[model samples]
Target: NAGVTQTPKFRILKIGQSMTLQCTQDMNHNYMYWYRQDPGMGLKLIYYSVGAGITDKGEVPNGYNVSRSTTEDFPLRLELAAPSQTSVYFCASSYHGGGYNEQFFGPGTRLTVL
Candidate 1:
């Protein structure tokens, strides 16, 4: 059922450019999240949404924005991208919040800013 899907598996962007990473899940999950992983660091949450029309910023939301207008779609927007923003972004979804439920992650989108 396409648990989760992300477009443009890989991207190369010039510094100061903007882009949008698309994420969609067909599982009807109640929780959706956006995370970024640096070369040698753990995943850091950028944004999350508990449900449609309910969104919140996460640990690292400085250069990004997210919107969850529907349960199945959560898109991340990156404005004025910088080299530090170059990382593999992952989109995940779960039926429940917290650690109670297993989150299904989509194949990450590798972004490179030069």
Candidate 2:
């Protein structure tokens, strides 16, 4: 529980399945984010929250949901998985929101859908 950590390093899902990607940080960061990276592409923000109970959608929120019930936990839920959702999901956290601050990233969860 030093930095951001993601559970289930890898997963495979059939069409229409569902799962939750768990993320946790022990640094007490106020800002948390969920991002997905497609093959050969940069990270696309899926959701973010400034603190507990303050969640918002990011650049790509379709088919995904997130909730922040505590300062250290942020989970991303995938409903009705699809082929388009196949990618590596990353969780990040920052003490502050700005270009000057550093964001810690989790190892990522590799999800494959068919």
Q: Write the per-residue lDDT of candidate 2 for residues 1-114, one digit (tens) a residue.
A: 579999989999999999999999999999999999998899999999999999999999999999999999999999999999999999999999877889899999999999
Across residues 1-114, which tens digit of lDDT does each residue of candidate 1 receive? 878999989999999999999999999999999999997899999999999999999999998988888999999999999999989999999999998799999999999999
| Residue 59 C-alpha lDDT in model 1 | 95
Q: Candidate 1 versus the native: TM-score?
A: 0.98
Which 10-residue span in candidate 2 carries the lowest summed lDDT?
A: 95-104
For model 2 the TM-score comes to 0.97
lDDT of 1 at 79: 97
Superposition error at 14 for model 2 (Å)? 0.5
Backbone clash pairs in model 2 (N, Cα, C under 3 Å; residues 3+ apart or in different chains), count: 0
